[model samples]
Target chain A: MSTHFAADTTVLLGRSMRHVTRSLDTIITTAVMPIAFLLLFVYVFGGAISAGPGRYVDYLLPGILLITVATGVSYTAFRLFLDLQSGIFERFQSMPIARSSVLWAHVLTSVLANAISLVLVLLAALLMGFRSGAGVLAWLAVGGILLVFTLALTWMAVVPGLTAKSVDGASAFSYPLVFLPFVSSAFVPTASMLGPVRAFAEHQPVTSIVDTIRRLFAEQPVGGDIWVALAWCVGALVVAYLLAMATYRRKAA
Target chain B: MTTKPPPAAIHVEGLQKSFQALHVLRGVDLDVPPGSIVALLGSNGAGKTTVIRILSTLLAADGGTATVAGYDVATQPADVRRSISLTGQFAAVDEVLTGRENLVLVARLRHVGSPGTVADDLLRRFSLTEAGGRRVSTWSGGMRRRLDLAMSLIGDPPVVFLDEPTTGLDPQARVEVWAAVQQLASAGTTVLLTTQHLEEAEHLADRIAILHEGRILVDGTLAELKALLPPAQVEYVEKQPTLEDVFLALTQEHA
Candidate 1:
């Protein structure tokens, strides 16, 4: 059964990867907004805001990557919604192969496609003079965290993809996810704020995640921030996966 | 000496399903013998899709039992799925993939050893070989529907369920699908097709089952069904040309 699952998922992944490769615009469009944010933050706001030393682009790259993922996951919802609308979902469910492979395929595709978008955003940051002195291991660690973060958020995207009544509704869940970075340490340090907003910002998942990634890039000791970051990603992944699967069972039933 | 009867290719007895308060299938019983076609005729909201969904293992019935190829759908869904292919109400082909790729995708999923060859053969048989390389998004409605049917034929499952296969198609396209279905009959595939079109049932099914208000009101061959109604009146009257006839004549003249 496990072997059948791997084969089914590989085949379905190839199918959606063809979709991803053909529709180059979904990736480009996803990358564009975060790239614009990177530019606006680095050039326009970098002069006024003091980010405590190095290039603002360097300080800002981690947050922009999060925004990139938040934006890219909407395409996952959009693609899944199209599958439901086309009746292909039912066709697949009625087939003899592993049924769970259908959703697993989409989740895997979201991770891969969002990884490409992250790379594009990273390239844009490099063009803006962002640099990292972190070692190869640190870079791999960054990749690992981002991969889990993407997986966690992709499952969240699946819920709306299954339940939303309209295309706009399906993709609408990402707006808040994209906005989450601004309130966190992504743009301005949470230490600067002094109120309920600061309290909320400091405690949120995005803050710890961004802090951990930023610290890694700066070659600073990650301390306990890395653990908190992994906890957030894994926690969100568990809850979202359960919610999405339950919803899928009802919808398929 | 006593002999056991052969199991049906598809069977359902007292199958019941509901969505909260809306009762869909209420004790619907049906059977399709091996190598025959059964047309499930019903009006809108008559639960035709519900029956097909249950039989194809896409949905669990609320009560009773269904079996496809001697495997119970509710108890042994995997076996039932292996024995049946479903062509849904819409064209389920992936719009981004080429027609041949769509066929190959299903063939591979069904574990066919040489998916490429299977796709190519089906493409030829459906007369889609010329356009098989182009993405399905660019294909006409008829072409897409034909490809949809062709995809369902892969792995050659014993039973096939088609739900409103020609619902939105033009007359020519409908005829094209009918021909494909006729080919399935000649190849001895057991088919249970649903449609609101009585003409379609008259043309394709050996047995027609009329479903109304969540139950089968009548089930029999065309002649038996016709007998249930009053005998046809024999009369002679002057013929009048239909608008279809006029349109065809004018178009032919212009050609």
Candidate 2:
């Protein structure tokens, strides 16, 4: 790609970022739900739910963070739907900028906004006696994993954003993503579950991701789970990015 | 130091498009001379916007070829896009941003020198100086349309396509937009506008092309088009003012 593509994406990213900053309530709103879940689970059910050997807050924080990313990506889809409906996409498409830059701007903005929400959730967890023994390298690895995961889901959000017939349909895809954590080892141990349920929880991407992150935070030896998490993230990112671009090209054409 | 002038600003031959069973444009032909305004007159669903979208490189034609500012639109979209700007039917400005911010964003994307200054200059030119700092959500429909046109002109492209620009504006706002368009044409920018208003075509277009059933029924000057129609039947009656005349007179008086 040419330098103009970068310049154009930066300019458009600035536009989307402004939308986020202008409505600070959107970021707060995304963080609020995950923080509430953190509070509800830790204070209400923390004593009852025995997740592994460590504190439940530490174990639950990874899942909450993932939910935060999921919730944050929904707004990306909603905003993209609004842009498509507003005819601004057509205006941008007719310009000389790189076509893919438009989608990239939305995806990058989603990453930035989700990262901020994740940090906010982390700070809240710390206030609630959630301690992490992980070092800077481990923290960086966790951040890398979350970033990749957020990128994958944000691209998945792009599909509904481009093709949804209504405003609600654009955002409805996130409901399943947010609920996926509940069925995994997010709030409870998969080993405690029944046969088929445990099998499904162990096989899904979120369980692997949450397990890897929980291990990273507890300073445990993260064996093949890290590889599985990385593979899931990278695989999802590749597939979602390809599908999103194909959908984008079809819509733009 | 003399060079031959460039060819037509826009040229098309047998341009066609279809959406499955629906054929939108069927072997359309057009030629827009440099620095001239050609109004594509058509009713709703007459494929006027489709033709404009294709010429602006926003959509690909299923068949035939089109060129804008001497570059083939199909093979050289970047060149075509670089030379042309479009203001879509809906005033497609970022409603979350202030007028100045919106203009600056487009100017920066177009790589115009000193984007802030260009934005300020455009705001002044478009009579949006007072509203420059206000978000577009608060602006009147007319103000938004002006800002949309200002954004399109940020690149200083030689060719411009305005797809039913005044579609949803009030009469007063429509006149204001027409004045701005006339100013652009006077400054030597080629403009191809699609409009359903016959008077708008008569007032702004150097040539009017009547689009019917996805094809041009007639393309020529207003007088030439008038010649194509059967002569008006003469009637001996007292002269009477038209309702349009009364409306214009009343609005002018109020102004």
Candidate 3:
């Protein structure tokens, strides 16, 4: 089984990658929401709110990327739900291939799809004067962090994909994830919020993750926020993976 | 890596399954001999799909022992899976993939060598060569079903389970699937198919087992099943062509 894992996953990955390539509109739709938010925040709201030092697009780019992944992973759930609904999932399960390859293919597709959408968001940001002077190492770190976050959220998306009874319910879980960035340091510094909101904003995982990415782009010392962000991402990944696998076992049985 | 072959191609005894308060399969028994076609006949909720699912290793049975191609479904599922192919009720072809690509995907998954060659062969065998390049979503229901059947035959597994392969197809498509099933049997693949259509059962099955309320009500060959009924009268009656015959004749002419 272990021997066949890589081969099976690669083949299945090619099968789903075709789905993404043929229907490029799914990618466009995924990026549309995040790009819209980016445009709105930078053009309409950036003037009213002060995000300290650099340009507002620069300060908010990390959050927009996060939103991009949040929105993109819904397609993962949607596709998985389509498979389950269409009986294709059962067809895969009954075959003699490594079962884990089925979910891994979708998870990897999520990474690639989100990567493209994130690049699109970055290009839009660059056009809006959101410049990042950080060198190659910082950019690599940023990529690593976003990759981990995408994995965590994609695994979470699988839960709904397996358990959801309706198409709408499968992708609906991402709505809250897209909204989470707004309450964190992605849009504003946590220091400006009053009492309870400030404490909630500071302690939440999104705040640390956004702060770490913001500092990385500016070539500043990442400090302990990077650790906090990684801890949050890894912790979420472990939990989501376990839950998704459990859901999968139930469905397979 | 070595074991003796089971007595039958498919052997099940006292299979049981339940969902919450509903008892889907309450001790069902079935058997299909090697290189033969056995049709399990049942109406809705008669546990036909559940039986197929368990035999195919997709679902666990509450209680029972079953073997496919000499591999125990519960303990030696990997071996059982390697020896069986399943074509589920719905056409499981990928909508975004072309007919040939769908076949190739299954061939690759099964690790059959020269995937493209295998895909083309199946497409030709299923009469889908002309439409092989178009995505499956644009194909007719019959074409999709044929492609689904082609995918299931990737490695020529000895045992095949088809769950109502012709449930919702038109008369012409039904004949196409029936022909495909005959081809499977002639090629020495043991087939266990479930369907509610008695015409289909009589048309292809070497033996028909009627399942009702989670039990095998009757199991026998078509001749044996007919033997249980009263003898036919000797009165003269003109035979008229069935609507099915008319439909098939008309549709085949259009082709």
Candidate 4:
């Protein structure tokens, strides 16, 4: 039974991947918004901002990566919502294939599609003089952080995807998510903000995550932000996973 | 790995399903012996799809015991799922994928070793070989429906649940789908289907169940059902009128 489920999931995962691949626009769109944001900030606003001496682009890449993740996960919710609306889920429920495999296929496709978008953003950043002394180990650590963050957010998207009544509802949740980076230490130091904004920025989850990724890319000692970011990611992942699974169970019921 | 034949294709007794305060299926008891086709006929919202969903392990029944291919649906849902396939009322093929790709996708999901071969076999079986390369979005309604059924058969499951499998097809397409269903039954597949078309039920169903208001109004062979109806035997001679004509004439004359 376990083997049967695993195989079925692999196959369905391939199906979702093919969909993602055919629609090159999904990857392009996900990468473009974040890259455009990165360019607008680093080229247009970089000279104005006092981001210390080391390249401002380098300092901003971490937050840009986070934005890239945020943009990409919206597609996950959109695709899942479409599947729900399409009655494909109803058809799958009748088949002999593993039930959970259907959900996993979509989740895995989200991860893969987002990973591609992340890589594209990184390449564009590199072209824009975003240099990092980070070695293989540092790159691996950065990849790990982004992956966990994406997984957490993607699963969170799953809940809204399954429950949202409209297509606008499915994709609308990401607006706040994309706007999250601006309020954090992504573009500027949170300390520069007014007292209230600074307090909110420092306490929120994205600030710690952005700070952690920034330090990792800078080859600086990633002190507690890594652990803090991990804690937040893992916590969000656990909560979202539980909620998504519960929603799936209810829908299936 | 080796394959073995399954036993007692589908079994159910006293199955019930409810949505909050409303009940959809009430004490529905049925047993489909191996290698037989059972047709469930009902009006919209009469719980025909609900019954198929429950048997396929898609929905949980609030009460009763059921099994598909010898595995209990509630206790051993995964096992039951492994032995069954469901084709919903609508053609559930992915619009983006071509017909062949859709079949191949189902083959891969079923873990069939030779996915291409399995897909080809089904394409030929359903006479979809000509349309195999076309994307489902471009296919006619009947063509897409055929692909949906073909996709369900890729795994060669012992039991198949087809929920209104022939709803929107033209007469020719309907005939083509009927041939496919007949082929599956001839190959010893147990099929449980729900349809509003009485002629379809008469043509394909070995046993027919008429469901009304979330409950089975009656279940028997077609002959048995006709026997239970009001009798006004008018033995047809060469000059006799049709049954409908007779009823209309009698009722109008009385009026």
Clashes of 2: 0
lDDT measured at residue A217 in model 1 versus the true structure, 0 to 100? 97
User: Model 3's lDDT to the true fold?
Assistant: 0.93
lDDT of 3 by residue, B1-255 (tens): 678645789989999999889999988888888999999999988999999999999999999889898899999988998999889999998999999999989999999999999999998999999999998999999999999999999999999999999978998888999999999999999999999998999999999999999988889999999989999778987999999889888978998
Best by TM-score: 3
Sort all candidates by DockQ, best to worst: 1, 3, 2, 4
| lDDT: worst 10-residue window of model 2 chain A | A1-10
What does candidate 2 score on TM?
A: 0.96
DockQ of each: 0.90, 0.81, 0.87, 0.53
For candidate 4, lDDT tens digit of each residue in B30-99? 7677888899999888999889888877788999988888899888887887788888888888987889
Residues B1-255, candidate 1: write the lDDT tens digits.
688656788888998999899998889988888889999999998999999998988888999988899999988988988888999999999999999999999999999989999999999999999999999999999999999999999999989999999989976688889999989978989999999999899999999999988889899999999999899999999999987568667866885
Candidate 4: deviation at residue B5, Å? 21
lDDT of 1 by residue, A148-239 (tens): 99999999999999999999999999999999999999998888887999999999999999999999999999999999999999999999
Q: Chain B TM-score, candidate 2?
A: 0.93
Clashes of each: 0, 0, 0, 0
Model 2 DockQ (Cα-based) = 0.81
Error of 1 at B138 (Å): 0.7
lDDT string for model 3 (A108-203, tens) is 999998899899888888888988889999999999999999999999999999999999999999999999988899998888889899898899
What lDDT is reached at residue B56 by model 3?
A: 94
Question: Which scores greater on TM-score, model 2 or model 3?
Answer: 3
Q: Which regions of candidate 1 fall more than 4 Å away from where they truly are?
A: B1-6, B238-255
For each candidate, give its TM-score against the true structure. Answer: 0.97, 0.96, 0.98, 0.90
